[model samples]
Target: MRVLKQVLAVAAAGLVGSRAVAAVQDDPWLTLLLGTATAVAALLAYQWVVRRTERRDVTELARAGAGTRIVRGTLVGFAMFAAVIVTIALLGGYHVHGLGSVTGVVGLFGFMAAAAVTEELLFRGLLFRLVEERLGTWLSLLVTGVLFGLIHLANPDASVWGATAITIEAGFMLAACYAATRTLWVPIGLHFGWNFAAGGIFSVVVSGNGESKGLLDATMSGPTLLSGGDFGPEASLYTVLAGLALTVVFLGLAHRRGRIVPRRRPVDAPAADVTVS
Candidate 1:
């Protein structure tokens, strides 16, 4: 009941918020406002539901050092994506034509912010956390990671390989990020940073979404393996490698910090009394 309630409440907020943002995409300012509101609504919904259901504070969103953590995570996320782009460029898979629209950047920031917050809350905050209690850290990561990837299949340009790449790069790494830090801020920042860099800075298609006119008039070429084809650089081998590296780092930290949870063994059912018939 707790899980269902929390999921439903937050999911509703996210759904409505995303729709509102989409409705106002033509107006950058309105999109930004609605996107910001959506993010806030999702957070508020999470807080309210958690309080009612678990009778505890949403400690994962504690305000202490939140800004610093978010900034740090954002920087790291941006740097990682930048590195991937640079690598692709060096390999002649990417090119820069000219500057893109500044307005696009603003709109993208808003859209990506809402997406990052809602998704992190839904996947890492609610699903992974609740499932972790029963299945433990490793199993929860696997389950949530796969679900995250599968959900993206609904995107316009989604494919099997694209979904697999997303599962490995984003799903596993983001969950591991939460497990390591025990907070949603880091993963949220990281998610936003990566996405913003992809669409807002590079003007590329994000997560198989349609074309984005961001800060740069950039184009991609070369092999699909290198350029990520229509699914974008997230499907590239570099992204998978980078994500795996981060996953290993975060999971190692979690293990060292004793945050990894072992699977709970189900209690044996009481043996029924067998009277000789």
Candidate 2:
């Protein structure tokens, strides 16, 4: 019941916020305003629901050092995507034409911000955290990661391979990020940075959402494996490799920090007797 309540509350805010942004997408100012509001509302919803349902504080979203964590995650995310784009460029798959709209970039920042926060809250903050209590870290990661990929299948240019790529690249990697830090801020920042770089900076189709008028007039060509074709660079082999590398690194950190929760065994024992890791 606790998990269900939290999920529904956060999901409701995310859905309503996304629809509002889409409805005002044509107007950059409105998009930015509503997107920011939506992001805030999502956070509030998560905090409210957690307190109401579980009667516990949301320490995962504590404000202490949030700015630093988010900034660091954003920088890492941008650098990772930039590296992938550079690799594609070297392979003759990517090219930049000229500068694009500043307004478009502003709108994309807001849009991506809302998406990142809400998604991290729903997926990692609630689903993975709650499930991990029962299934352990690895099993929860697998379940939530697959669900994340499956949801993206609703995108316009989605495919089996594309969904699979997202499962590995974003779903698993982002969850691992949360596992390592034990906070939603890092994953949220990473998610925003990656999507913004893809759509706002590179002017590429983001996760098959469609053409984005961003800061650069960019074009992609070459094999789908290298270029990611219509589904965007997120589906590129380089993205998967990069995501896998991060996942390994974060999981290693998690293991070292004793953050890896083990599967709960059926026994007649006190809850306090069970040790994590």
Candidate 3:
């Protein structure tokens, strides 16, 4: 029953967000506000359902709040993506063109911020956490990660390889962040920062979804394997490698902290109450 609620909650969130975004596609700022609003509403719904159905305290999760962990996580995400950009630059795959406009900057930032929060709330806070309760850690991670990647196929220039890249890089790493910090805020921050830096700051294509411009006016050139083609630098092998490295670090930290959920075995029912009927 709890599992059913979780599924319903996630589906409801997707509907709310998709519909809201569609309604305000013309105004980037509106899209941003509505996007965030949708995420918050979805979160409340999730907590309400979980608390009512499972009888668990939702206080701790809320009390965790968006604090220093969020800041640090955002910075870490930026740094990792920076490393990818730098690698591509060194390889002569990227070039600086000029500066971007104010409107462009804010648009991308708001869009990405909304996207980050929405995705983290749905994927980590709901799906991964709920699934872990039954499927355990590794299996939950794999399932959520694949779904995350598959969903990205809806992006503008998405491809099989791009989806695969997103699955392995983002899906697992973000889940690991939740495991390590035991909160959704960190992963939300991480997602926001990565997207903002890539799309808003660096003026690059993000996840093949679309492009955004900011301070740096740059363009990607060279092989798709390195440049990530139309799917953007996110498809670059560098991103995959960096994401995997982060996943290892976060997962190791979570394991050391004893946060990884162990697989549970089913207990046999009292051998069917034995014979005398």
73, model 1: CA deviation in Å?
1.2
Question: What is candidate 3's lDDT per residue for 152-233, written digit by digit as tens?
Answer: 9999899999999999899999999898888777898899889889987898999886666677888899998899999999
Q: Write the per-residue lDDT of candidate 2 for residues 28-60, one digit (tens) a residue.
A: 888989999999999999999999988988999
Estimate TM-scores for all models.
Answer: 0.96, 0.96, 0.88
Candidate 3 residue runs with Cα over 4 Å from true position: 22-26, 269-277
- After superposition of all CA atoms, the RMSD between model 1 and the true structure is 4.2
Higher-lDDT candidate of 2 and 3: 2
Better of 2 and 3 by TM-score: 2
Clashes of 3: 0
Looking at model 2, which ten-residue stretch has the lowest summed lDDT? 266-275
lDDT of 1 at 17: 95
lDDT of the candidates, in the order given: 0.94, 0.92, 0.83
Q: For candidate 1, write residues 118-189 as lDDT tens digits.
A: 999999999999999999999999999999999999999998998999999999999999999999999999
TM-score, candidate 1, is 0.96
Which rank order by TM-score, best down to worst? Answer: 1, 2, 3
In the predicted model 2, the residue pairs found to clash are none
| lDDT comparing candidate 3 with the true structure | 0.83
